[model samples]
Target: INCSFQNSVEFSQQVFVHTSGSPSFSSDELEIVEGSILGKHYKVEAFLGEGGFGIVAKCRDTTTNRAVAIKVNKSDPDILQQAHVEIFILEQLRRLDPDAANIVQWNGFFHDGERVCLKFELLDQCLWDYIRDRNKQGLPISEVRPILGQLTNALSHLSSVGIVHADLKPANIMVVNRHESPIKVKLIDFGLACPASAVMPGEFVGTVGYCAPEVMLGLPYNEASDMWSLGLVAVELATGVPLYPSENDYDYLKFIIETQGQPPDHVLDSGVYTEDYFIGD
Candidate 1:
């Protein structure tokens, strides 16, 4: 896989697969079924959700009978290439951290003619949904502390290793309460995450409310970007409300800036930032 970030969208059109021995086949020669069960490989249980990227479905791995979440990329070449890059990055990160409690396990990846599929461990609920439901019951802060602690530890570990999870919102965090010696907050979805040390050429990449100020300004970014997102998560956990409440991207960013202020000097010192970004009105 090409690790270097070129214009992935342009290069994706040239993607071809070949077999060295006996016979060779090109990706163009293969076919795919849209909105159909993949069959044999995975049994589709239910639809999970849909996003601009593609559809996610809860599936049972037929061979192992294990439940997994399958994310199917859009048919567009650019989207498909972006998904491939995401899967590759996830595979590398999983190799670095194999502990099931820390991150989502990537079962496998495959291409279905028109799209790429990523198989991830399926969790019952996302952190955001869990908090919303718990809030309806008016769960005490004390009850939620333990869950928050575990997540903080995960963030600490990732940050220590120089990995900044660009998208650290409630939805990206998964809640797994199996046999709770300690509640687990498995960090899932690396589709928006990038290496903390790498300099991103673009200004936009992450979710609106969760995006760091530096990221929105089209500047470089580092670990502090993740911290900013974490701060938003902390606010949500503490109040059961989003720190920046806005209906759209522009409004969301405005809300954050007006309240959170600009990124602190310590954040800018990380060398992945600029002052041009604003969070909210």
Candidate 2:
């Protein structure tokens, strides 16, 4: 991994969320079920997962006889806006080869009734499930290394276009195939992702444990925030444990300071939320 960011070594570290915040969903909101045909040609096979934005389903394209994954948004205003943002980012990503960049391939988008749906190449198990399948013992350095390389490749591409994944962690990373000799992975889920320039203060993003210092400390989030997340993920893959497993920001910051030492003074001083984390020097 030729990760050449200036602070690549320092920055390293979702479920999934958007700026509007998660909303309560009634059962009827997401109406897709197995055998349901979406966009007329894609037949739903199974529900893959659900997150802040919408439900992901494994579907088969009847016309082409190919497996596909569709993320069906909840049709609510905020969800629709989030879908548009993700599609915008995905379009920006088209400049890079999805395979070489180690990013998920987006097929396109369509409307499933009033809801917005995104089509993508179907992928295998997420890293979290893979680790759990192994009884959470974690991967050896040999295995962890390749995954990191792939992820770094993914990040490098995102950086070129000034995109911040916002949520980067094991669950959001998917293995192309577990049996493949040298494992391959792709970055998934962009509901929380945004252009680095769009990042704003007081708008929370990403899972607490995997979130970066700038995000937690109320500073502007840049592409570097995603790198911080990648670092923590590198550790989790090798250790099978999160370095800062805390629901509280203060607790998480404390764990980070204990393990990595206090953040540089300028880092602390720049945070809008710095007062919450610091007292008199």
Candidate 3:
């Protein structure tokens, strides 16, 4: 099986083998072709992006003629479970605040055979790409301040609702209106998000470089973890470089120690995998 994107549209081409007693086409051979109709409402236009769990596409809503994003999950069971969780969290957030300007707008969800497709309001590029286009010179503090303020407010709102955006990074944040003076932004990609109280201690989550120390150490974490990520993002936006550009777990811990000093004995002791990196106390 192989996959590729053209014109921002996702297409999959598969080669299959046929047996004397079996069907020529297998379930995995099926794919959402470009220009295909989805949910009987969305007209697939272009592929937006893809991740380990799913692919995102730009589509048009036939009912409203509005541009939207459709996230189509792979047929893997774990990915399907995440898709369900994301949909549930978005629905709950919508119920809590119908007009959350700082968060991506979730239209609804539907299933395309075994695949789950989530519908969302299409927004502009992500902050990661936006910052890259700015020649990686880092944005002015004047601009960075506003983006941080809005993100802080969004995080606060999530905390109030007992939700934690486990994955908070530049790429997960969408820029709404880049041409405007005060650029508008919205948080997207809630696949790794979960209820603050539901997350078990030492659960691995979030992306590297942006992941919080507690998370990297496999310790219990909460909304504060997101704050840690936000702080790193702010620095990246201001300097166009990651504060801790470690390549792996050991290096990440080393960078943290070098920049912030060794963790307090208690913090190191609390980490489940501390002994792997640290010598005797």
Instruction: Assess each prediction's global lDDT (C-alpha) against the native.
Output: 0.64, 0.81, 0.77
Give the 10-residue window scoring lowest on summed lDDT in candidate 3.
13-22
- Alpha carbon deviation, residue 121, candidate 1 (Å): 1.3
Q: Could you give candidate 1's per-residue lDDT for residues 1-281 as a string of tens digits? A: 35343333212323421111112222222232333556347767777666666667787777888878888766776666567657655655654563533777777676666677888878767888877887634335665676667667766766655666677888888876633545577888777655565545344667777777666655677877877888778778777887787655657756765766755666545533243343221
Question: How many clashing pairs in candidate 2?
Answer: 10
What is the Å distance of residue 79 in model 2 from its true position? 0.9
Best by TM-score: 2
What TM-score would each prediction reach against the true structure? Answer: 0.75, 0.87, 0.86
Q: Supply the global lDDT for candidate 2.
A: 0.81
With a 3 Å backbone cut-off (N, CA, C), the pairs that clash in candidate 1 are 220-272, 221-272, 253-279, 253-280, 254-279, 254-280, 254-281, 255-280, 257-279, 257-280
Which tens-of-lDDT digit does each residue in 148-237 have in candidate 3?
998998898888888888888898999987888788888998888777767666667787788888877868888999999999999999
What pairs collide in candidate 2?
11-228, 12-228, 12-229, 12-231, 12-232, 13-228, 13-229, 13-230, 13-231, 13-232
Cα error of candidate 2 at position 158, Å: 0.9
How many clashing residue pairs are found in candidate 3? Answer: 4
For model 3, the stretches where C-alpha displacement exceeds 4 angstroms are 1-30, 98-101
